[model samples]
Target: MTTDSKRKGIRLPRPLAIFVWAYMVWNLLPVVAAMAFSFNATRSRSQWQGFSTQWWSGTPLSLFDNEEYTAALKHSLELAAMTTVISTVLGTLLALVVTRIRGVAKRPVNFILMIPIVTPELILAVGLYLSLTFITVWPFSVVELGTPAQVVGQVTYTVGFVVVIIRGRIAVLGDGLEAAARDLGAGPIAALVLVLFRLLMPAVLVGAMISFAFSIDNFVITQYLSSDSSTVSIPMYLYTNARGGNTTPALNALATVLVVTTLLAVALASLLYRWATRRESVASDVTGTVALSA
Candidate 1:
């Protein structure tokens, strides 16, 4: 009964497998319908008349120019890029600082950063909106928020998630690698360049991608902080179009693009990380064998 298994002996439970399939179907049903409807010839999303790609082609063009899908896409991309750069820089610094901390202060700092992550988005959005009010601080008019301020506000909440993710990676990367490099006469910066940066690169990249996706899909925070119609992102565009007795096929098309892009990037990142880990594991095993033989 205890025979060797070539497949690593890992197996999903029957009930668990059933549940996973059911869950996937439930979650993907709407997405699947949207994608299918994106290609439908009819204007109505409910009826499956026939297949056409007009939504994909000439999207937001002559027929759909009023939707503002093109402008909204540009806005979302710009906002996502800004959020990614700011969050990645801030989060990486947080991870680096966390790695250097070895005392009681670490827990409190981490808790404070993580508190925003666990807080409900609705509550956070409302709080951010209230805080932006013209209520006087020291009798002077408070700094009024615009699109840039909205991005900053959202990034504040986003940095917390990024920090937690990168911190976990940094924690796993113990001090031994840096110690070895230093013992070999490298300076602190040199040691970090030679040891720490290479090891934590994958985690940092993954964290950045996650932050980018979150920033792009963010609705509640952006909704609360949003000021001008010009600041409208793709999510906000989709929201208003979905409501207000308006239904555009371009929204479906945009959803398809978002889902595909997100999935592709995530899949590529996962594969890269797995391949790197596998190579490292194999190299370590080979080195261990050589050392044992010696």
Candidate 2:
């Protein structure tokens, strides 16, 4: 008779396999396709004529040379960078208060935060337009509701997501460490700064990065709120070109870049998380070993 210890285990659970398959087909496959087509030379979409890098440098980017593409790219980069910083700061603050405080403001702040993330972008866009348009009656105080408006609007949407992310991490953040720091002749603020803030730094970085990605791709609010061509973001530019029946090889090129950048950031975030957890695990193991040795 065969020993039970020698028997092979069953394959992975069916549900996990199915989920992996579904996700690969629906989300991963299309991205892979676009990436592949970035190098494909075809006048028409979906028909791979040949492989070429013409799409990338095929057209020289210049102000007179339709640098709208270049301009949009730069604009988006700036916006994303700004949005990331502001949202991270605001979100972390919001998360800290909401999680640590107890009052009417906690629920209200959370509710308001959820509204931006959960509500449809289209509805938010239209609502913003109405609010901005109508609120401006006086010449001096009447703020010009435009690209600057869109920047603020995008921030409104993105900061909420950042809040949710930071809050999730904050919930799991143990106060025991901070308490001990305080016990060790440290002030409350000092304990929090040295212990709590340092501990949550990874979450803060990841949240800001995630918010940056989202803000980079936001189109609906940007389109509705942006008044002129000065602040046209890459997403808005792509939407216009695609919808207006203007097909270009560069579209695939740009898409490929976006996909790669997104994947890279996601990979980086995953790596950071793994590294952080691994460090914690190693420290725990060392502590356990020393205790056992003692």
Best by lDDT: 1
TM-score of each: 0.87, 0.83
- Model 1 residue 32 distance off true place after TM-score fit, in angstroms: 0.8
The superposed Cα distance between candidate 2 and the true structure at residue 96, in angstroms, equals 1.6
Clash pairs of candidate 2?
none
Residues forming the 10-long window of minimal summed lDDT in candidate 1: 1-10
lDDT by candidate, in order shown: 0.76, 0.74
**CA lDDT, candidate 1, residue 283:** 82
lDDT (10s digit) by residue, model 2, range 1-294: 222333465577999999988987998787777667656675455778898776677455212235777778878778878887888888888777778767777777678779988899899988878888776565313545665676678788988877777777767766678879988999988987888878877788787778777878888888888878888888887777764555666776666656666666667766776776677767866776678677
Question: Candidate 1: where are CA atoms >4 Å away?
Answer: 1-9, 59-67, 135-144, 284-294
What is the TM-score (0 to 1) of candidate 2?
0.83
Top TM-score prediction, candidate number: 1
Candidate 2, superposed: residue stretches over 4 Å from native: 1-11, 14-19, 61-66, 137-143, 243-246, 284-294
Q: In candidate 2, residue 253 scores what lDDT? A: 69
RMSD of each: 3.5, 5.0
